[model samples]
Target: MSASSQSEPRLLFISGSSREKSFNKKLAKLGENIADANGIKGTFADLGDYPMPIYNGDIEVNDGPPDNARKLKALMEVHTGIFIASPEYNASFSPLLKNAIDWVSHIKDGGLQVYRTRVFALGAASPGGMGGLRGLAQLRLVLENGLNALVLPDQFVVPKAMEAFDDNGHLKNKENQETFKAVIQKLARAAHVLHG
Candidate 1:
């Protein structure tokens, strides 16, 4: 990769839901911690911190994206990989998550760099048996085809997530925890290679 095209060695974690006690949010943080343990620098992205109105092309033509979109784009520019923990809503990812992507997708002049330059890993945590895997399926398709992102093949799912974590947000089951950590480690390794 050319020097200018290579981003810094960092990973980004984003939770599809913005709820304070959301299991998906906790999963994203856990991914970050696991990435750190695996010797990779990481950052957790909060959608709450980057609020914007529902997407509208008229608004974009009139005023461009909200300030938060620019801020999010800047963050994406620094990280070479992304981890997304999506919440299930109506058999798909939450509207909040989709809206965020829609707004960011409107960016031009290298705005789509995040999708093409970085590798993305999709995961989910849900109280249901399906573990939000159904929702993740839609997300992967949208990110890969709609946005043209390079999503990782391996995905992590936390089923019955409400009962899966402890007070510290760590998964109680040893096997599940190990699986989650393994996913993070793989993402770090892939990011390292792609950034070269």
Candidate 2:
């Protein structure tokens, strides 16, 4: 690929939660807007749009991964980088997100091709004091060790996420906003080097 094409990162932004007004969903949207403003190609996605059954070995053995899983995998394969706004669930990432990952990983099509080939960045928003940082830590482990994916070290968290954003959906905290932007930029840089 040409240098310019390689340098331009195509990012997939996903919110792990499926609630209509989920904090993580809004956070994902903010990330998408920031990426778009910076001239990066970013696609914001909702887990609700690609629903899959809770992963089951029996189902996999009998039927195979659900069609939604295949569709999501296809969408992910085209991107050079991914950004996930995970929701905290009992100090870990949500089951909805976990199920999706499990289903996608089960696909034998390219054998972890999507995870191995792309760079990932993680962020979270929670009403608690930790700002969903705990969930992100676990998510990082899954991406790095389980999937063997390249993930950016820096992560963004929004505490009291219900009030973290402004009316326009932008982060109200300037410092936090900058940190999120930096994380996204770092992902872009890493993806370019790896996929270029």
The digit string of per-residue lDDT tens for model 2 on 100-190 reads 9989988998648788888999999999888999999999999899999988888888999888899999999899898898888888778
| Number of the top lDDT candidate | 2
TM-score of 2: 0.94
Question: What TM-score against the true fold does each predicted structure earn?
Answer: 0.94, 0.94
Q: Give the TM-score of candidate 1.
A: 0.94
**Residue by residue across 44-107, what tens digits does model 1's lDDT show?**
9989889999988899999998888888888877788889999989899998989888877778
Error of 2 at 168 (Å): 0.9
Runs with alpha carbons beyond 4 Å of true place in candidate 2 = 1-7
lDDT against the true structure, each candidate: 0.86, 0.88
